[model samples]
Target chain A: MTRRATWRRRISRMLLRCLPQLMPADKVDWATAMTREFDYIADDSAALAWTCGCVLTATKMRIIAMVASFTNTPHKNAITSVAVLVVTALAVTLMVVAPRTLTPAGGGMAEGGHVAFWLMYFWPVIMLISYAATTRRGHCLPSGFLLLSLICLYVMQIGTALAVGPAMDALFHAFGANVQAWDTTLKLALLVPPLLTVLQWLALNRLDRTLTVRSMRNDSFAA
Target chain B: MTRQRKASAQTVTVLVELANNSGQWLHGYAISTATGLKSGTLYPVLMRLKESGYLESRWEASPPAGRPPRHLYRITAAGLRYLAATDDDQVSTSAATR
Candidate 1:
């Protein structure tokens, strides 16, 4: 392959990687739409710039959204709230203690850390899939569920990246380790929060309308 | 059907563009270029308008060989009615005496 094509391939692979997760479930249609547009663009430089901008924007958005969601709307129910807290506590403990404390033990702790890692990884993926499916099927109830879950994932990712990249980079560099190798990966992971917030905000507003209509139908039937 | 709310500037831009070439099936990218809205903003606005019954969209019958089929959007009857109603309201409210 030519040098420009190689670099463009790398740019597409590295930067737009987390786009699937950053994109809300319902907006997955736009994902397909954008991929085509990106491909159809004549200028490689413009495409690279757009891809990089998307990554940067997505990451910044998630941090702000997580804070807002936490401050404004905590939970719909006590049980789910408590359940989330317990699972989160368990995951954090596994992620922190599992690798260092039990590396000698090997599989179990390492695998536990992996599980914790994938929870945040697959969390948004699952919500996004749920949204795309439901929106296609004309199911609004699960669409709302997917929307809320995605916003949470955006927040979770922003928190994880903020905690992971810089802290780990500093820790490794202090030991004279080369942290430069991780800069690209760190950037891609860090830049995931923004895209979904716009979609999440749109969904959040319209979600109530669907819910109200469903509830009204139930009320009429009861009467 | 409920009368749609007043169009935002972005929405109006899209509408004006579509109404200017009414009945012509303009692709999303073409509309984006015409309206000067970024694809990011334009797609969401288009999707909302489509969902709100102000627009209709369909995939192109035959796309250029290399590119994927484009989605063509046009204003629906309800959409034009909304534009006309807003225009009528504007005309009635105008006054040289005032």
Candidate 2:
């Protein structure tokens, strides 16, 4: 086979592997069907076209499923409101605490710390306002809530990196153990938050699925 | 209960294709090829039809070696009724226009 043909085949194989992950759980059978159909096309370009179409279809289906799962309920609304309030309070607390804890008594924060502090302070408030606007326009626990939560999570992460790294270094020094402050801060700030964010997103999806299932069961009983 | 909504032109085309092969179970790719609909368009229509009891589907029981089984769809009795109703609607509208 030509190198170009070989590359097309490899790309199509890779995309086909991702097709099922792109689909919602219930649509796995359809994803399988589409993947199997790809084996029947003789022409490489046609196979690639088929794979792209299936990928687009799966993505569209997944988005629709997510939106449908988040249909508005009073319970969801209450939970979301409480969540927003808690995040806002956390942001406020961080805004107040980080500056005091991180800055030297007679001087200001370092330039990077200063930028991180302001970002940790303001981004959540802005996201909260955006979430409010979206909900006011009548959406069911808008994806904005997720975005807000993620932003708050990053802000908290920044605050932790600023506040904890120096504190840890000092403790380690007191124990005659050496640790680099920048290394600790960089790890705390960069690596941990993304991992936590992915967990948070997964947890949110599980929660939403549970709520949707419960509400559906209640609705069926009502009917 | 399925709501009675107007079927779009593409929907009608799909229905007609499936109705023509009433007893035979056709998989998605074949239906897409025949109806000139992309996979993106075809699957949603199939989902709606199945949800509305106008169609039924199952995974193929047996398949050729080295190939995974595909999901096969067939028109239900209610699908035939829907197609008949749609044809009648078109006929009356055309008659009125003439």
Candidate 3:
């Protein structure tokens, strides 16, 4: 019913709809790797999407698998879905609270803005490493390491928020301002890279599809 | 009649079994054995059904007696509806065939 829930459902639906052609499980066995590799090298757009879908699906599966193991229930799908919805809600709340502030200017990168910046930059890497280390991929204990790192990071954020709340207001006053313009600027800077990356990916996919269609047409003409 | 026979004759009898056994958390191994499908074939079908939102699976922890883990699969609400519709169609076709 919340805006966040509505958007999450929308995005999930879009992702699922786009998934069938690109899902990695289309191949029945490991031996299909060679063909998959060749398809990738040939720069097929469909194959690229399939690769992306597979990796995304695998990462999601890993999250569910880990949750299931913890609960000792192979049927933790419903629970995992709830967790994802909660995470999405948290992300929306953070965005609303932060409200597009510019990254604060130089407390030698120890300011509240700097802390937020690092949190955004570093969390995905930790999530991915943990994902790779677990499930059928190999190297198990690294899963523990990944979870530890995440916990440590969350604890540090809590500590910083408590320690810096007063200091941030004081610093804003010292800069002769009542508003936090730096946080807004920093947010814009942080957001641009990912947005650009997504746009570039989509454009590339379109181009690849056009080229594939052209190639197929030429082949038919030659035949 | 012809269509009922075709549907009835389909491998694994998913309709009858599901119609009879709906709502139970069935084991993957049980389904495989009943259907006479190899693990490979059954697993992919299960995975596909899960992806399509027709079924669900959960891992049950090993019992305190220290057995290995097992996954239990169940038909979702959507799957139940699909099975019911298929059963209806089969009944109509069977009557026509008769």
Candidate 4:
């Protein structure tokens, strides 16, 4: 198979693996449709780009599913929520500190770099929002807005990264310099979304287990 | 599961598909494309429909390929009533008429 086709296939398989969590339906139909869409792309660049977008969209969907399920189950204890909050705080702190350690002496990040730094916190903010959306027992307005904005922001983030990537690469080449901090910063910026998602997946599984046990106990008592 | 929250546009779009198809079994991919719903949006809506007793699904055997069978779905009687009660002709009044 050609390189582009191979890339698309690999990404498609990875995304399909996550489909079962969000989709109750058999995964085969989604897989077939994803493959057809991938194979239909005529150009290599377009195919590769489409693959990236598909991965992001799928991951976002998976997180949203986790949030909904997590919210549906009433928390018998707040330990899980507290644990996630602590981890999120630490993550935010490390994200702020780690990139600075990579900076070349006397060299600093540009304005875009500053923006990216703040944006790296997007995952934490979304995590907080998800917690609020699911855990709270009140009107849904705040959580609803949070959900909508985060989705929009993530889509915009991916779009902006794709659009600015080539220009950033060209500019760096023009500088003809090895910038360690910039390199680390860019990598962290991209990593935030996926890292947050993995955290969500783990939290969901833990809470789900707790929920199941609680329900089982209630059932036994009822019997 | 009987969430009476007003159906979002995407949910209504799905209802339209289930309504139009009536007794016909529609696969997820077909619904996804026809309703312009993403996999993320489409799947959750499907689950809700099932939970609400508005839809039912069964596995349809696949081709010689080793992949798992596909999910075939159809709207239930309650689903038709939902469509009829909340019938928005803009989506497709035919769904209500049926």
Candidate 5:
């Protein structure tokens, strides 16, 4: 084969390899069929066009399958997942910006501010570890242990809020800032972490349930 | 009672092609060429027909040396019934317009 023809053949083979991955698992047989049929097309350009069409078909099927699965999911579970993501974004923003706002001008952070700062800093890491542990051990760990872990995370968040809110309130009072409006704002702002932690727990629980149900359905179908 | 929806023009074209070759297993490429349907459109239609129990498919029992087996498709009895019903619907609609 000439170099150009050989290049076209190699590209077609590479795309054929990707066809199965683009298709849904149950429809893999169609990908295999398309690959085998490619050998019969003598014209290189036609073969390439056919291969591209197969890839498009596989992609369209995969997207349809995904949308169907998403629709199958409970609306409450979907809503909770979206809410968790949005709240987590807000919390991270607050964590990054709050320290600057809370620190007294030309001085260090308010008393006990470091406690809140470090807790907020490490909060994402803590949540990551929690998520990894829960999902990885989802089958092995007792439900009680999972609940206990979530409760502990929640308590830590609430403790941080209670501790840091008062200290920031006191610091603002000493600076003779209007305590009347600032006091309520400080308390509410501090509650975000704990609220986020609760949402995380709910989201995790919903995910776990959805996974368990899916596996059970698959098992039943297999049997 | 399950209400049957009207098939799209493309779907009707595919069904007619398959039904015309009843009892003969057709491969994807041949069907694409014969019906003048592109692979992207043809495969999904075939999949939907299979899912709806109007078509059946299988791997070729034996393939040429140095080549993998191709998939083959055939229309089912249900598919013929569906095609006939569609033809009747078209005939009645055309008569009504006249």
Candidate 6:
């Protein structure tokens, strides 16, 4: 209702909107800090906690699917690995082409283009590193990776504002577009990457919780 | 002087270590480094014990010991009992092996 609250709501919505776009399509495994022997361990309680991915992401879902498949036939590990690769490839294609062909209007040093490029590039690398680490330890991907991504997002946004704000203002003035329009555009562009990163993390966390619940159910039944 | 190989201590050994050093206020960092464990691993174990009322911890007071008040931990009465049970189990296992 208040002006500040209204603005906050708009930003939140904007961020939530972009997160799904940045996320990998297939579920990531929430368990394991590094990739290693994911089979049963000696200590059920500790092993469960370690491998039970506490955060949900598409990566986690994919891991669950793989594990479930492994349960059916351990020999399916190779096939599961291939399936993961195929799914990842498809997701990458979808992300790249699914912007609905919105022609980015270049207003002298396009802010949106720069932000999108960096976010897309950086997010996947972080995800990959995290995936590698948590495989054996069976812990959720380190929170530090997520934190680092956020910091990069913040720095890029500031850089964009300082770089593009002035250029866009001049361009808008020279043309007929209003200064306010350029400001809003620049601000939204700057905000996109960080928002997307947060959304991706939230998705990952959701996957983690779901996996934990499923594991808990199975464990109780087994007991 | 020859450097001794660090003792390969297990979770039970670490618990025993805490029990062995009970009554003496131990700093968290010192315990972690001595045990060759990441803080992440050490903190969680410490937290579980404290929450279960098996361990008690406090911030160390300074002067003479002019260091930052560190988290100091000691085993509780319950913890001592737990340690004794573990000892009994070890003894039984050793006897069975013999």
Candidate No. with top DockQ: 5
State, as a TM-score between 0 and 1, how close model 2 is to the true structure. 0.60
Whole-model Cα lDDT of every candidate shown, in order: 0.55, 0.66, 0.45, 0.56, 0.71, 0.45
Looking at model 1 chain B, report the run of 10 residues with the lowest lDDT sum: B89-98
| Candidate 6 chain B lDDT trough over 10 residues, lowest sum | B4-13
Question: Once superposed on the true structure, which residue ranges of model 4 sit more than 4 Å away at CA?
Answer: A18-76, A79-223, B1-3, B62-67, B92-98
Clash pairs, candidate 5, are: none
* TM-scores of the candidates in the order shown: 0.47, 0.60, 0.29, 0.44, 0.62, 0.30
Ranking by lDDT: 5, 2, 4, 1, 6, 3
Candidate 2 local lDDT, B68-93, one digit each (tens): 78889999999989888886666444
List residue ranges in candidate 5 displaced over 4 A: A89-223, B88-98
Q: Which model, 2 or 3, shows the larger DockQ?
A: 2
Cα error, residue B69 of model 3, in Å, equals 38
Higher-scoring candidate on TM-score, 1 or 5: 5
Q: How close is candidate 1 to the true structure, as a TM-score?
A: 0.47
Q: Evaluate residue B38 in candidate 2 and report its C-alpha lDDT on the 0 to 100 scale.
A: 78
Residue-by-residue lDDT tens digits, candidate 5, A54-159: 9999999878966765687667555554554445545543454445446776788866567768887687688767766756534312344444454566466656
| Candidates arranged by DockQ, highest first | 5, 2, 1, 4, 3, 6
Q: List each model's interface RMSD.
A: 3.6, 1.3, 12.8, 5.4, 0.8, 13.1
**Chain A TM-score compared with the true chain A, each model in order:** 0.34, 0.46, 0.32, 0.32, 0.50, 0.28
lDDT of 6 at B69: 39
| C-alpha RMSD values across all candidates | 13.0, 10.9, 18.7, 14.6, 8.0, 19.6
Candidate 4 docking band: incorrect
Candidate 6's C-alpha runs over 4 A off are A1-223, B1-9, B33-41, B63-66, B87-98
Residue B64 shift from truth in candidate 6, angstroms: 5.6
Per-prediction DockQ comes to 0.18, 0.49, 0.03, 0.11, 0.66, 0.03
Model 1 DockQ, alpha carbons vs. true complex = 0.18
* Tens digits of lDDT, candidate 6, A121-185: 76467555644443322223333433344444445433543343344344345335556554654
